[model samples]
Target: MNDQNLLERYIHEVGAHLPRRSRPDVQLELRSLLLDELAARGLEADNPADAAGVAELLKEYGHPEELAARYHTEQFLISPLAFPAFRLSYGIAAAVVTVVFLVGLGLRLNQGGLDLTELAGFLGSYIETMLLNFGVVAFVFYLLEGLGWIKPAKTGAGWDPHKLPAVKDPDRINRTELLVGIFFTIAALLVFNFVPHWIGIVSWHDDGIGVVPILSDQFLTYVPWLSALWVSEVALKALVYRAGRWTRRLRLAEFALSLASIYVLYTIVQNAVIAKLAIVDGIAKFALWILLGIALLESGWQLYRLLSGKANHPLGVPSIRENQ
Candidate 1:
């Protein structure tokens, strides 16, 4: 494509990644700046070197997602600069909690599901544990950011343009999303393995709202397998976040997980009385079936993507490649 097309495409890609609220204004500013720069260099569609010029200009601009991140003011319990590390720490804490509770529950409970009183006790424990762990992490980060002890990386004269990451595919993995996924995966593993009663019915009480556990005896039997699958998911997501892109092996691993999910869901839906309440049990089963379908679809897609000539490869740093 010509230089104008390349410029528009680049703007489109960056705009696609930006938050909707800021997208239009950012895209407009980005387009005007790029066009002006191109004009100053006399690099237009008529110029033979236009494509290379546009690419060079965009490379200097930075990674699309990084650029989009700049336009965003969105943050969580902490600044985005500190969030990636905090998320990993959160996942580790979740895993620790899961392992400890699972061991304790295994020692305390028999082969059957928890009774109403036992479920209530576990619910209380869950509330207390959540408050402690989540509160500590949130408070510490909040204080750290508020104190300006944590800050974004500084860009200066020493910064190397060649250090810019390779131009990612449109489906580039979002590290924040992956990190959050890892955190939630571990949380799922913990909740199901320890406080299975967490997923229950909500009702009004004299004091306040209360939950009646929907978990059944048959569901307890699958706890070990579900825990293993969720842990695997967390590990895979963590690896992907660290790698910053998917590799052939990672895609294969994801495919395997997708297949495993399909099998587990399929098995569970087969006469599995997963919940105690009839309505809840039917909804749970239906949800499993829906999940099973999704897994199957994902498995098929992964297989096709794997067999296709265009498989995911490791991301290369742009400057590193240019230097090499």
Candidate 2:
């Protein structure tokens, strides 16, 4: 009821949640700090010395939630999963112990509960073994973290919370970068298809026509290059959904690969079928032109992102709120 009692009660409440090894010392330090804070506030008026008045003052000072939270460290020396919340570690420990206990108890029960007079002897044996194994597992996880096998992610001190830039909804990803992806798709088609035959690596079979190989005979032998071309095309499109400097350039590289693949596919198909090629030649040429048109437009867009330099340093760090 008095100042000392109120501080003691607060200490007892917090100490109950802490590890037994440090509880006494933590309680004493907290008790002294609380008293000091009250004295500084000059709440030492006559009734302030009274237990009820002290209780009200302590209540006004708030539960030491902040003090309690400090005990929960982001220390890499402990399991990332472990914390001041003993229940996290205890639940796992207890569950393991419980399972072992249950198995032992079941085996004994199945033997017909025959040990009536010496029940404590059997019970003690079961608890001891189960707890020993449980403690081993708990300590192993702690030690593994302490040994730096499972490293904790950077937080607090490593990251400059104050340096974080402000976020704006309007500053959503830049629109021009999306155009780069479209451009790459087109450029890929032209580079692979329309290029002069002075660079034909391999002619498809006997036919004068030959399409480029996408996967290559050494790679898969039969799968057409068109498949890889299409796949890369789709992937490039997907990458555009993300707006970032590095990703933007990676998208460009993907586009070039896709285009070269298309060229190889065209040559492979052209060399494989000579008769039907005439029928498909016009259609293929038309497709390449359309792709080139799109590519030109996209190139202009990419140029804009590069000139603006936004593409050069695209935001690498993600927005935390989005992660949540």
Candidate 3:
């Protein structure tokens, strides 16, 4: 093929990926740039009939998708500004679905001996549910953004450099920890509220399979409060992520949630009775006690910070009172 034909094919491929409204102009601009680059390289565009020359020039230009992607300015359902939050939300949703599927699978296995066919079916359903949840979360965020209900801050738009948060302590707000907390909290809420039966054990014997409930019926009574606490914790962690720094208000919120969590754990530990499994009961009680102790320590630490005015300013932001 002639150099002209090859160049035309390249341009056509790029144009194919571009939006109709901008394709023509983009193609023209691309062609002009290519010609300029070839001329700068001491290559004659008209004689690009030389396969080697055409190859070299085209290589410099990049692939069609790469070139087209650079020219596309349109944002999809989620804008770049809101993408981080959307991603976190999607991850949480996926985690919830996975937890529910796994727990439900265990319950099913206990109730009716493990069957490969049933396991495969559950896997298929789990994937479908995750996809549906992702789509719903994306759509909701799109709607919220469109309605101006959640306006993500844009670059150089009323941003003050001096007000940037401080990060004196590298471990002050661990993003990974917060994200993990968000995922597990959401998963726990889903498992307890929607698929409570999954919180049990499955045993297989010579005769048949047996299922035993780990949580007592009274445990259901505390789920509402537990769910609410989990929801609040998720919301607070999300806010911390968005803010990228901790302030007095956020610290107080964290402390309150931590205290509430300890109380919830205490109640659950006291009332969660296990049937037919003393080991399971012991394990559950021990885990709850450990969690309660951790919560108390966290609450105490946050209270100390707030009282000492350490939480008054963000990492980079200096306290106004200190300046005065």
State the lDDT of candidate 2 residue by residue for 231-260, as single tens digits: 576565556555443454764674476457
Candidate 3 worst ten-residue window by lDDT: 158-167
Report the error of model 2 at residue 316, Å: 49
What clash pairs does model 1 have? 162-319
Q: Please, what is the TM-score per model?
A: 0.48, 0.27, 0.42
* Highest lDDT model number: 1
Off by over 4 Å in 1: 1-171, 313-324
TM-score of 2: 0.27
lDDT tens per residue, model 1, 200-311: 8889989999888889989889888888889889889888888777778888898898888778876777757888887777666655655554566568878987775235
> Clashes in each model (backbone N, CA, C under 3 Å)?
1, 22, 6
lDDT against true structure, model 2: 0.49
Rate residue 225 of model 3 by lDDT.
89
Candidate 3: residue 93 lDDT (0-100) = 87
Q: Which model, 2 or 3, shows the larger lDDT?
A: 3
State candidate 3's TM-score. 0.42
lDDT of each: 0.68, 0.49, 0.67
Point out the higher-scoring one by TM-score: 1 or 3: 1
